[model samples]
Target chain A: QQQVKQSPQSLIVQKGGISIINCAYENTAFDYFPWYQQFPGKGPALLIAIRPDVSEKKEGRFTISFNKSAKQFSLHIMDSQPGDSATYFCAAVDTGFQKLVFGTGTRLLVSP
Target chain B: DTAVSQTPKYLVTQMGNDKSIKCEQNLGHDTMYWYKQDSKKFLKIMFSYNNKELIINETVPNRFSPKSPDKAHLNLHINSLELGDSAVYFCASSLRGESEAFFGQGTRLTVV
Candidate 1:
């Protein structure tokens, strides 16, 4: 079963706009949530991560807003640029487990 | 220097062939993982190792095997490969369970 579910498999955003992708997990035990970005022909790289304890985390133009109660998290890219176009994946893991359950990815295309 | 690296960015082979993808991390992390991404960009974990010991093995096929020579390296061997095995394989490393993971550029394997 897919523990994590992401919506809007594809997204389009204009440069300087805000691009948001949302994810939800069914496993309540999941405590760590992370977002990764992958360009074509490249590996997924960790973009930003957040824990359930905090409601949100901001890293420059990227931010992760996590809602512990809803078991949902969203990544927002502010001032999106063409370079920000990439495939984004969200993953959740239990505290003591080495494996992570990833959501169906979102392909974001930012056009100038 | 690249933190995590994989050999042979592209692998093209025929069915029933046996192949291996090697991964090494210079970050001195104790945990490594192998992930597969499919046509629709669904990222899934296949295996994980910690300190050269198997820790997590998902419901992947028996044809897939993982070997870890040390904490810095984890290699995946796929035997009797089928057309379904054609996908992008990624290698990742983390400090431990539920921590941030660093990924290597994927290996695109096309099975004809």
Candidate 2:
């Protein structure tokens, strides 16, 4: 069974528009949620991360809004640009154990 | 310098053959992980090592084995390659168990 589920298998946004991707987890034990961005022929890179204790975390133009009670989290990109086109993955991990469960990826396309 | 490095960016091998993928991390992290991304772009954790000791092993087949000679190096060896094994493998390292991870450029393996 998939521990984490992500929505919108693909997304397209215009430059200066907002881009959003959502994810939900079934396991309540998950405490750490992280987002990864991957380009073609490259490895995934850490974008942003949030802990369950925080309702939201923002860095630069990337923000992660987390709802601990709803077991859901979403990534928001402000002023999306063409360079933001890539695959995004949401992952959950239990601090008690080191295993990380990843959600199905979301491919984002930003057109100028 | 690359924080995490994996050798043999692309490998094409026939069925019943054996191959190895080497991974090394220079981030001074104690935890390392091996992740596989399938054709559908789903990423799954296969193995994890902490301080050169095996910590997590997913339900991967016995044909796949991971060896960690040291905290900085983790290698994967496959025996009897199969078409189903064709995918991109990534190596990652983290300072803490459930923290942000640094990933290496993936190694694409195509089993014929």
Clashing pairs in 1: none
Q: What DockQ does candidate 2 score?
A: 0.77
Candidate 2 pairs with clashing backbones? none
What docking grade applies to model 1?
A: medium
Interface RMSD, every prediction, one decimal place: 1.4, 1.3
Residue-by-residue lDDT tens digits, candidate 2, A49-108:
999999999999999999988899999999999999999999998767877889999999
Candidate 2 chain A least-lDDT 10 residues: A93-102
Error of 1 at B108 (Å): 0.7
| Per-residue lDDT value at B38 in model 2 | 99
The per-model DockQ list reads: 0.78, 0.77
lDDT of each: 0.91, 0.94
